[model samples]
Target: MEDEHEAIDRLSTRIDEKLSSFSTVSLPMCFKVPNLLRQTNEKAYEPQIISIGPYHHGKDHLKGMEAHKIFYLNRLLQRRGETGVRKYVMALKVKEEKIRECYAEPLDHNIDGDALVEMMLLDGCFIIEIIREYQTWNLGELQERNGNFRNFNVESVVCDLLLVENQLPFFVLSELFHMTPEPNQENDEHEATDHLSIWIDHEKLSSFSTVSSSGCSIFRVPNLLRQTNEKAYEPHIISIGPYHHGKDHLKGMEVHKMHYLKRLLQRRGETSAHRYLMALKDEEKKIRECYAEPLNPKFDGDALAKMMILDGCFIIELIRENQTETQKIDVDFRNFNRFSLKRDLLLVENQLPFFVLTKLFQMTGGPNQENVQGFIPLALLFFSRVMPGYGNGLVIRDQNIKNLLGLVLDSWVPSLKARDNYRKISKEYGGWNFKYSATELHEAGIKFKKIDHEKIVIKPEIDEAGNEVIKMGNEKSFFDIKFENDVLWIPTIKMYAYTDSILRNFIVHEQCHNNDTRYVTDYVTFMDCLINTSKDVELLRHSGIIVNNGLGDDEVVATVFNKLCDSIVFSKKSFYSEIFIKVKGYREKKWNLWMANLKHNYFNTPWALISVLAAVSLLILAAVQTIYSHLSYYKR
Candidate 1:
């Protein structure tokens, strides 16, 4: 053991070091919105026009306003009669460590200590200048003094300043706010303390010119179609595009919209966000035309650009984060639900134009990258669960994907050989003429075999003899159905709570648009033909062709497919025309239909079946007796 005094001195020094470290260690005032809550609405927590703190400081779109911060800092210095930035820099440096420690995560990843102090000085002063303007109500004089019209939106800036992610520590702000030579007005100090309350005192924010538009690529679900199932068409977690932009229940995801914009800028550094803003501005006419509903008058070009960029970036990030998981987003399991976000993305009404999403996605590509991955594959991966093909590892050959739903429709397409029967539209594709339910087909000595989608099979090339491609054998989409050799090969269709909604949305999308081939509709119509009653549902369910996931009972599945096509008045179907013809051929022979009817109807009653059995037994005994009598005569 050491001497007492020596130990005491060592202990004292350790205590001092610990005190210094702990004293400077600031509690986290700024936190990343939890991924679960962030998923709700992405835009509400993000800073759009200006980013005040390090979390959003380096974003390209928000970066354009940096010069304005310098300008405002100069204005602050001039108004306070200070000729130099020395004192302001010196003041912020003292509290830099504590200021940085206020964030939930380490700030070193975003900025160095010196740079952090400078940001604090600039942001603090910028906020002060905006408040000062409000205090004096001399925006015109200030504009005149600057000799340049303010290029940024004050209202949006103020709104950004108030964002949780954009906030600086209050002590840092308060200390910087009180640094100025105090003017005679007591209100100036009070305003500085309450600087976050700054908002443009105007009724309307005119950031861009207004324009009118019509004829939309994104349309609302018609009541006729939506009436089948309203929740399927509506977004539960988040909204996309202009139609469901600001619904209160779905508002929680806006922060994530803003967060990913920040994340996007961090990952791929481009020039000023003004580049994207101006690009979107030029697209105003097209955007207006794409939405079936008129652009809200309140949504000018600038406002629209801000909303779109946030939403677009948010969407891209959502897909990216969910890219690695199986059937769900990679999440902090405590917060994010196990179910996918595809429910919202797949809706017909809840869509951003594929072009808009592609535009932002392509433009945001990292400059150093040699080859950028196409958006189609990433989108396909995110929606693999709902897509008929699983959409994973398969080569996507189509480039004409119009939107998310359209991508899924493309994925549902069977191989060329599988589609040989459905390539051309048959006059009877949409007609309800020759049909046999699953039960009826089973009774006709036509074997009902479920195609296991989990195995792998090679679909031979239509043109090339030796060329073939591997496809889902056990795990396949519902669209691949075949009738051959007295057997019907139907792929499994996993029914979930959302399956009805997913298929309904797909059907309605086809019903609304004039698709040359209604792939989803034809598939649903084929299923409707196969499942006429609860008995048919039972047959399919028993064959492992219909896997129920949380959806209750066979009767519900029966009612679902039974009523699928009832709401559609005008629909053209072609994908399953060949399969329909083959099934018709099997049932067309009089013997098949008569025997199927006999097995289905006659054997179904107890007494009648017993009577038939008794009659058949008596006939067999009489035939045996005649054979014995003939044998006896031959022996004599």
Candidate 2:
């Protein structure tokens, strides 16, 4: 029994050592920030000097926080000389006033003060004040072991001071010093006696950048200020949208607006235009930079971009890749003078399909410059979506829109309309009428028409003994697949038809009886790459054919799928090994179908047809022989 207890102790010690090692490697940088700040303070502490926060929580918590070691805080404060210490003192004073204001009570000032101090401690502001007060006072008496308090601000202090500060006080008081120190602990402390302090001097905090006075500092939204050096309401960055506009639209534009606009575009030759993207921290500086001529026609490239935004969805846009060279550069402004708004501005309504189309356009390239003016809104929407700090997800929820999108993607790629001798052809395809509109279908409650199979017939019932006493013969074959009540019931296949592509693939590729479905994903992806990319699908002809061994129960799911393939085809050994290691589960299944088609297709090999013909001929010969033998027997 003694040995068992000893072994348990040994095991616990090993576990604790392992846990400490793991924490060092796995903890993130954020976990070290608070500690770093504490260390900065520790380096500034003098051996006899002690600092405390005006706030209760700060004093109470930091009184023994692992980061509160005197040597570290003092070291940090030393670098800034006395200036850093003074600044910390001022900040702490400000925090103290804030704490007092929060805990103000009219009656029984002592109770109010006590409650307020404890409240501040609970709020974390108290700790900040304590650290500030401790640093400013440099009270050496507070550093003594079993240090006695000179004064009590509230009820009896529920804390004890220790000469050493290496870990959070809670842990030390509760675990290490809850009772008299063990013999080993006493020996360890005797050999180690060091005092130090450190401080990290940061630049003065600005009012706008400091944590909000309202305790809700973490969640407050940032306020963007306009720059006085530049013009108000005019951003330093200008993004021209994909929508086209005539050059005449640019004629009456405000000259002042143009100046700011040009500056924003950086066409004036300075790289400062990009500064608009900076956060609110440098809003004023960014504006001043824009004053240096932002945009110039000569150097500034045409701002052609398509942008879209939803009330809730993030903004989306399409910026043209580059200017394409055409033989004739036509500059026609005769009928292009209208100031039309971007399609996205009209609101969602029944506009899902059109919205999707605009998104695709934005994904492609920006509009041509014949319509650069009168496109600021579109440009703004586009930039809002593609801008570095913005996040948006485009989703088409309307059924009509989804169907129309499917058709459009299936039919033709989006492109610009070109003038021809014949009347101009609308670049838009699919969703030509309200029938294909997303709103129209949704209002009508249209749904996909599912094809139904013939009803299944019931079979004769059998008893548990397997004895058919009653003569029941008529029955229907239970081999047809059925989709009933939103459930895919495949009686023949004995598998559910999962609508989700991934789930279905998992079921097929991983869960199927033969693992026959597993290879489909790979095959599909391969086929798509081959066929869509102009590569000949026939190239797969050399690949081994995947034949489903009719034995469903004996089929391999995936582990042996490749082995079976090699068994039948006998391909290169290295190719087999490479495939097994590279592909785990596949995303494409069409490639498998493509491979099967390639192997079976008569176009690839005339020999297949020849083989079929030979088999038919042999069957015919056997029939003739059988008929001849029967006739001879009858004559005998």
Candidate 3:
């Protein structure tokens, strides 16, 4: 017994050693945001003027920034003295192995240990110098730098610094800042621990308590549409998260964001911004974990909290500006020209987590002072003009929503009960199959009508097996299409240039986070199946089912739907399955086919019906004359 116990203990010790070895190689905090996503919008992920970290290091286009980096490094060394520079380099060298582990893949062999140390020294010093410049400017000790850096375009640099791939660990920067402390700046050290606070928190607010979380809210777009139009998924005007933070095209909107942030702070009175920042600081870990990719360590609690506070406040203020209609004298007039901006905010890439927005709103007297409905309603109102057929009689529960795009899609989807009804009816009918197009159905004696002012509500039912069965009634909107007496009732959809982008992003979000309930994908797939050619588009247009909003020729619309559905794999269990079964059943009936043939061949139009009636009358007259003549001959 003693010998057996000794052997078991040895085996357990070996297992523990192996587990410890595996844990030593920690998971990476940053990855090359998948090539599939990058292929769609290379500019969205790529740094334009400056490359912060080694990912795009030494590229020909980014070589120009090397001079600026050296300039910043020289400035940093001059201020810190030679001793401080050596101290920063030594601190980073000690963390070299650990820092390398933070990358998703191994760095190039050419970038040897010394090369990496040199790169970090240069990059980290440059970053510290820029932040110090910004800090001194805020303190009225130094003037704003001239050249391109003075323009609003320089905000792009700030954006580039925050990207997941373009980051240095927070501890490295914190060490450098501490080694070269500014004179009489002891009290500000806590706020200056991260680079983000220098740019975002100009007020120098003190740190506060933290918060807990339930789960993550952010997600990556599914890879399904990566090969399709990249612009459909890319944000045009603004960026929200680290995914597309800083691009040259989107820099114009930064001024607007700052403007909105200023207005939001003023509206909240004193200490509101501080309170908002503290609340966000508490929930920092939850926010970082919500992202699909692990965030760079530089996005420490304070850095993330500042981002959430600024971004959340900007969005809330935009919603408020649109809803209140009060003409504030200082408001940027370009913001009111919202057709493009509103669409930009709803893009999957350009979104803050919904919960963060709600937290900011509630804390800032959004519910009490605003007298508005809620964040969802305010968002709906702001986006209503761009997204037609939405925000009307729609109720979105907070728990059900994931993000802005998710909220819009959830509102458009049918309720759980309605989907269950579809499944049950589809099962009862033995399976739903694809049928004819709108034009073919019309030829087969089917009619088309538009549904207006009807609300679709779902009711619950229980079966004998104790399972919940969805009993569909007229009160609920089942599928986007409904067939009654060969008449297909479809709601009108207005198509615009951004319509495809909205649908594509919504589908991506649905596929990524809500795969089980793919309501949007099912609807798009159904529409794609129904419209095979341009003639199908024309038929729907004539039937008042499709309203075009400068989307070009009808053929283009047909091609859009066809291409949108390309490579898309939809579940067989769809909300439209039952409607499809009914249409197929009606088309298969021999009596219905014969009646349709009669209608088409003899009574298709008023002129054709009149000709047939005249001929029948003439035949009756000829028959009477022949009978009279036969009677006269018989008498003779």
Candidate 4:
């Protein structure tokens, strides 16, 4: 009997311990910027203007925004008339515990339940009011409260509100929002009561929900490269997603976003905004899950919905205006260069969910009110300006392209089946072991030729052994190379100032988001092998395979490629394994080696060719004279 009692006690204790462990393991939506990534570029991860969530909540510099929060909260209450603040506080009280659970870290003991509720109330009201003000442009009341509010930079505030560390749970804001008065339905009890029950249902629904692993396509830049080149991942002129929300340096671009936003409203009509907002609200939960991190506490369904609508509209409009020559001719393109905007849009951190863009484009009736082809085509057109052949021969519909950078990478990389074949080839042919430079290959009689990108096609074939094979067909692409007649025919690749940034981000994307194919990394590795010095760069340049726009000197280009190669962790399998084997086989041939030496010695230039022919003629005459002298001696 004692043994049975002890066993029961032990089982109970184990159950209690497991429950305790589960309670402590909260789902973290937002994470404290990793120490390694932060150490490299502290500015990229740190909030500059205002703090949104608990992480940077009580910082001294960010306290200035506290006054604005209170002001917005007062405005919200005033719009509600009597007992508004009390009702908001009461609603948030019920959500205080739920809100605390959303963050990965535990709340400080000093910030009791009351303090937490009040923070939620104030921050929630501020975000809702700010978004409302942006939509309505009603600065009259704000000016009356404080003249400086009229001059406040909306861009900086909008950016700050979206940071990962600066977010509030959507439920808390949704709860508080129910207490606020609704326009045109002030007397409708059902409208106000409807939201209260909806919030509860959302709470219950969210608790039981599990985000699928494949759902989140967005990813932070890999820590390895982020530590070394944060600027490469960061947006210089504009903030897109929650990651690099509000920096002072990026304020100039905020005005442009605003201009684009206003233009969008003017062009699409104000009703279009409402339609897009509704569409985003419907997909808010899925959109939030798409982000790798949980949104900041400030982003309730309403606030996030508003942001998606505005940002999506701005992007769609920007693409539309840029494409129409009449619009382009009227606007001063010099101030807002398409190339600069393209760079900003392609940054890994600066991206919206492609779905949001697609939804907005569809809601706006698309170009000509037809199917939603405008978004992808316009996006491709924009990127192709910066990266030649980016959209050429690409079926955008065939890809699960997540963002601008993803689209750019999809255009350049081979298909999944092709990548698998390449991996198999690499494994079968002694792995990715080739490391000869361009100059070395040239010396080994491997002549270099430029392939025309227009005529190339990538075709899949079945080998004699019944194995499926894929080859870089006649399809000419940026990195396509073919070996024929002891020559390596490589397509021309243009290297500009922004090439490093584009390549690095694409590599980082592959490192973080993609697991199967490392096409960009493999391409970089192959380039590194081919380019060891300025002579290699010169050789490629002479072959018309490299179009150096603003990459400075050949030494600089060599250093760039070398450093890029050093940073990435290359896979054992490579996309160019078959080509490497062919080059190696050609180099091993004695006849080819002899022909290379003979060419280098005697046929390097026109003058050298003429001198070699003269020498051969003299040798023939001397041999004939010697033969005649021998014959005369024999006769005597």
All models: lDDT? 0.66, 0.25, 0.64, 0.66
Candidate 3 segments exceeding 4 Å error: 1-216, 296-298, 327-337, 366-373, 390-395, 415-420, 423-435, 454-480, 594-636
Compose the digit string of candidate 2's lDDT tens values, residues 1-636.
Answer: 999999999999999999987665423211112455658775332112222222222332233231222223333333323322333333233444333332222223443433333222222322333444465553332221111121121111212222222112232223212222222322211211111101122321122122212111001000011111112111112212211122344333223224433432353255442332222223322222221112233322212111111110111212221112221232221233211112112211111223333333333223442221212223333222211111111111222222121221111111111112012421221111111111112122222122222332112233567632221121211211122332222111111111112112111212111111122233222222222211121112112112122222212222122221210111111111222222211212355335434444632358887877788899999999999999999999
RMSD of each: 23.6, 28.3, 21.2, 19.7
Q: Please, what is the TM-score per model? A: 0.58, 0.19, 0.57, 0.58
**lDDT by residue for model 4 over 1-636, one digit each (tens)?**
999999999999999999998888666675677788789987666665567767887875566456556556655644654323445555677766667778888776777876677677768877777666656553333322332232233444566667667888877667666656455335322232434333422442233234333356666654435656667777766677666666787666666666767776676666345666677889987788777556788888888887776667667777776677555564534566566667777877677888788777776754563445445556655566577332233344513767667766766665445454565666434544676788767877778888665533433445577644333343335655567778887767788877878888777777556345466787788888899899899999888888899879999889878877544545444667778788888876898678767776878689999999999999999999999999999999
Alpha carbon RMSD to native, model 3: 21.2
The residue-by-residue lDDT of candidate 1 on 1-636, one tens digit each, is: 469989999999999999998876767898888888878998788775687878878775565466557666655655665445555555776777677678898775658766787688778877876777778754433432332222322445566777778888888778877777455332232222211112110110111112111324576665445555677788887888877889997887787667678767777665357778888888977777776455678788898888778888777766666655532533323343434457778888888777778788778765522122356556655666654333322333334556778766666666555555455545545355646888888888788788765533323122245433333222345567877889888877888777877777777666555456566777777888889888898888888888888777889999888877755532334566677787887886799989888987778679879988999999999999999999999999
| Better candidate by TM-score, 2 or 3 | 3
Give, for candidate 1, the lowest lDDT window spanning 10 residues: 200-209
Candidate achieving higher lDDT, 3 or 4: 4
